[model samples]
Target: MKPSKNIVLIDSSRPIDRDHLLPLGRLRDLPEQIKRAHTVVVTKCPPEMDIADMFLWEQRLKMPAGIEVQFTTLKYADPLPVFPQEADKRYIYSKFAILLTSIANPRHLRYHLLSFYKISSDLEFRDHHNFSNRDAGKIKRWALKHNKALIITTEKDAQRLSALTQLPDEVKSRMFYLPVEAVLLRSR
Candidate 1:
């Protein structure tokens, strides 16, 4: 299907470090490139995000002076079994859990999980990482120490978890992921 509009999202949870979009004080793209966009959606904003911060991004991205800068957030959803066969059982939210993620930024995912479960530990990997049996061992060790621990991952990471067949059956049995998606915040 042809696209009607183009949208670029910037995570709002973290402050814009460098002058430009790219980090490390680098100039990756021309100001005009970012300004010509039809819409810019800032993602991963915390619940306390304010208008002052929204306007700060508008000025920083070099967007048009009066253009509206809409915001979006990482809205977390229901927890699902990592292994398909275990679908019938409801996730035990009360259990102490370990946060596992290979996304670019995992802070928000960790924050979201803490609201529902006790966070025992975290295993963060590079963005788009392919989990290995070695990595699974670390999670297993952590869960082993923490009684009734659930190893929870993000929805995107859940897709990758299916490919991680080498993980121990023990870990697979207790693992699950909470779905998360970008949701636009109330307009200014």
Candidate 2:
């Protein structure tokens, strides 16, 4: 199936991965893909991002003149419990957090959380990681060690973490996920 036009999406949250800015695995084809793109959407950007910097990105990416470039930022909602039944609501207000992430880039979420809480520890996993029982055990142990700190994970990882039947009551009580949605920033 051939699309009428291609829209290339670039994540503005992280540093450029060498020449190709996208987090795709096939690095060689990305530049060509961007060249064919009718519009380029920069995702996960901060709302207050400088307009001049956006133009700089265009030059850095070598985007062809007249190609439309748009910017977007991920807006995060209030923390939601992974296991509502076991969740202790007070943990949501904790001053410290332990971050667990299985996404390609967690820097944006980390930056957001730093505004409200002191991140004590960070646990990172490969993108789309399947949570194993051992992984659950590790998290459970970590929660046990830091009983007062809120255990936070991205909305995507929360799905996999909640599916683990072996997670203890303690872990479930302290764990929460922040839901995120992308909002486009209009060029001034």
Q: Provide the overall lDDT of each model, using Cα atoms, as 2-decimal numbers.
A: 0.72, 0.84
Task: Name the runs in model 1 displaced over 4 angstroms.
Answer: 1-6, 14-27, 30-33, 48-62, 65-68, 87-91
State the lDDT of candidate 2 residue by residue for 1-188, as single tens digits.
99987877766744344555335442546455577878888788777878788877777777777788888888999999999999998998999999999987789999999999999889899999999999988898878778899999998999999899999898898999999998888542
Instruction: Tell me the tens digit of each residue's lDDT in model 1 across 16-58.
Output: 4434645753335654665655777777787677788777777
The TM-score obtained by model 2 is 0.88
lDDT, residue 166, candidate 1: 65
**Among all windows of ten consecutive residues in candidate 1, which has the lowest summed lDDT?**
13-22
TM-score of each: 0.78, 0.88
lDDT of 1 at 99: 82
Clashing pairs for predicted structure model 2, backbone only: none
Model 2 CA lDDT for position 133: 95
